[model samples]
Target: MSYPTSSSPRMWWTCTYAPGAQPFRGLIVPVLEEWSKSNVSDAFPFLAPIDHLLGSRRRISINLAKLFNFFDQEIVQRRLARTGSGSGSEKNNDVLDILLERHAMSKLTRQEIITFLTDMFIAASDTSTVTVQWAMAQLLRHPEKM
Candidate 1:
């Protein structure tokens, strides 16, 4: 998938699934931006190790690509469902959810499950890292107060 462009207002929605796009909504953007202010120049040194691991963009663009790929896979799964005889009660879950639920259904192969897990881990890490940093800052600032 290509990088998001300003041409489309809904580009972020296309890149990020609706549930995942919650943070990009107006309310969350301001909060994220406010939280991001703590990440000015000085934060770089502290984030150096992670920067080396995930790179400067934090692989956000890459994850957006993967998310797009996930959409394609969903289409494939839909076709499979249509062709295969399945009841209407068939479960509906996202890729990561399906990967985890596979222990009961065993639909995906081990390797496929692992790759799905990796993708989810990377996606979650991207969001959680920022939250962790903010919490850490609050902790450090309010050591005695906390």
Candidate 2:
């Protein structure tokens, strides 16, 4: 149920990028931890209007933007390397590879590719962690039933 162990495979599968322990522990994990914190706006609908006033939304946005930019840069570098290699025949079974292939066919744009990578990281990483935590809590609470 550890975040890094649980999340790393999903991230790798999606982006073909493994953040490794340090970046996962220091960067991705902290963002998820902060995001898990409760917001007052969640309890009071009227407070939603002032959610940004507390700066939590702003901070989360900035952090997420940084994460997205990191992925974007990595994707760009991969594309550059692929072109620079001068052998376009090579292919790997990764999401980035698939996206690039589609891009070559004019099926997707650069911005779309970046957005897909960002969404994949966020959705896969967070959902896997939450699902594992929920399953563990349920099993612990109903050990006899299991």
Candidate 3:
């Protein structure tokens, strides 16, 4: 939850949830699966699984791209401007703001932004969810050993 950083001010890093929170997902998922069976013929019965997979992915992508954009607009452009070439500033206070600002003064375009966001979304979401699932499964099967 908290770790030491080399930076002057020790940053209080925040994870979305605590480490033990993951195994609870495994328990809740099984309960949801059982419930889905009873409502299988209902209109939104299949939403649980589909959303569990897709929603995490989508949000992660959007957030990460926003993160990169903020840095690009804030840190990168400021450094670039010292050379009298890039003279731009972002309107907002985020990663995407910084990136969009730099892009306005540099070579990046909308197409690249979309492509990067898409790839990052797919990779970060799927890998994170699957890894959590696998770890939880293993822990459930070997609680004593763990």
Separate clash counts for every candidate: 0, 0, 8
Residue ranges of candidate 3 with Cα displaced over 4 Å: 1-90
Candidate 3 lDDT over residue span 1-146, tens digit each: 11111221111112223454543233223322333243322458557576555455455445555545532343444445434554433133444444455567776775565455335433443455557779999999999968
Identify the leading candidate in terms of lDDT: 2
Off by over 4 Å in 2: 5-26, 136-144
State the lDDT at 138 in candidate 1: 94
Residue-level error in angstroms, candidate 2, position 97: 0.8
Q: Give the alpha carbon lDDT tens digit for every residue of 40-117 in model 1.
A: 245567665664464434544454445445544644554355347565334445454445356447777645654554
Clashing pairs in 1: none
Q: Which ten residues in a row have the lowest lDDT in candidate 1?
A: 1-10
Alpha-carbon TM-score of each model against the true structure: 0.32, 0.74, 0.33
Q: Model-by-model lDDT, in order?
A: 0.45, 0.68, 0.43
Give the Å error, residue 128, model 2.
Answer: 3.1
What order do candidates take by lDDT, descending? Answer: 2, 1, 3
